[model samples]
Target: MYRISVDSSRCQGHARCMAFAPEAFDFDDEGYAFVPDGMAETAELSESIRRAEANCPERAVKIEEA
Candidate 1:
């Protein structure tokens, strides 16, 4: 399985992940990307995470096998 993690400290509120995967990422009131519940098990979650990680200019998103 793949584990997705986002380092909020590194996030710049750019919303790049939201554009790549709206279902997996949502913007908080401050415009920071946050992952809602059940996102890890979604069928398209992995792809979404991958896209987000790749597209993140701040390199705050990461994916790892667990």
Candidate 2:
């Protein structure tokens, strides 16, 4: 499975993640980057998600295999 995580402390509401991959990311009321619940897939990784992960200014987006 592919899992995505955003460290709340590190998130600065840049929205780059959401902008890159709206289907994989979103914002909270405070505008922090967050991965919507149950979003990880057992399928392959997506380009948007990869770009989002790589371009996060805070390096907050984390991708892990589990």
Candidate 3:
């Protein structure tokens, strides 16, 4: 499995990650991107997820082996 998260400090509310991986990311109240609770762990290494990571301008999207 893999763990996904967004570094809130680095995120600039660009929403690129949401565009790429809507199923895996959501925005907080202030419009910053975040991985919803319990949804961080993913069993599949989806192409959209990789695209989201690559497309994030702020480099806030994080994916790590779980």
Candidate 4:
């Protein structure tokens, strides 16, 4: 398993992450990408998730082994 996170401090809400994997991310009214509280399986390690990580022009995505 993997633990995935978005550094809100670094994210500029370009929405690329959501474009790559909408299933794994949510946007605030202000349009910040974050892992919602109580999110069940958004961290599942998959190609799409990795694509989202790479898609972030801000490079805000973080992934680590869980």
Candidate 5:
């Protein structure tokens, strides 16, 4: 499995992460991106997660093995 998170401090609300992986991320009231608690990771989702990480202009998306 993988643990995904976003660095709110670094996120600029560009939403590129959401664009790439909407199923893996959600937005706060202020528009910062967050990974919802206990999201399931599938092989397809992992691929999208990598794209989201790569596309983040602020480099806010984080992925770690769980």
Candidate 6:
């Protein structure tokens, strides 16, 4: 299994990750990407998480096996 992680310290709040995968990433009031607690495991969400990790401009998102 793969887990998605975001390093908020490096996030630029560009929202590109959210645009690429809204289901995998949520934008806070300030437009930072946030992953919900349980959405990581759904089959519908895995590709989106990968896409988000790939498209993050800051390279702040990552997916690793659990």
Top-scoring candidate (lDDT): 3
For 1-66, candidate 4 gives per-residue lDDT tens digits of 667888989999988988888878898899899866654244457787889988899899888777
Model 1 alpha-carbon miss at residue 56, Å: 0.2
Rank candidates, TM-score, best first.
3, 2, 5, 4, 1, 6
Name the lDDT value of residue 25 in candidate 6: 77
lDDT of each: 0.76, 0.86, 0.93, 0.81, 0.83, 0.75
Question: What is the alpha-carbon lDDT for the whole of candidate 3?
Answer: 0.93
lDDT by residue for model 2 (1-66), tens = 787788888999989998899999878888797887877653678999999999999999989996
What overall lDDT, based on C-alpha atoms, would model 2 receive against the true structure? 0.86
TM-score of candidate 3 versus the correct structure, residues matched by position: 0.94
Residue pairs with colliding backbones in model 1 are none
**Which runs of model 3 end up more than 4 angstroms from their true locations?**
none
Q: Could you say which candidate leads in TM-score?
A: 3
Q: After superposition, how far is residue 7 of candidate 6 from its true place, in Å?
A: 0.7
Model 5 weakest 10-residue run by lDDT: 38-47
The clash number for model 2 is 0
Model 2 — TM-score against the truth? 0.90
Model 1, span 1-66: residue lDDT tens: 666667889988988888888777776798787677666544334565688889999998867666
Candidate structures ordered by lDDT, highest first: 3, 2, 5, 4, 1, 6
Q: What value does the lDDT take at residue 3 in candidate 5?
A: 68
Poorest 10 consecutive residues by lDDT, candidate 6: 39-48
Specify the poorest-scoring 10-residue window by lDDT in model 4. Answer: 35-44
TM-score of each: 0.78, 0.90, 0.94, 0.83, 0.85, 0.78
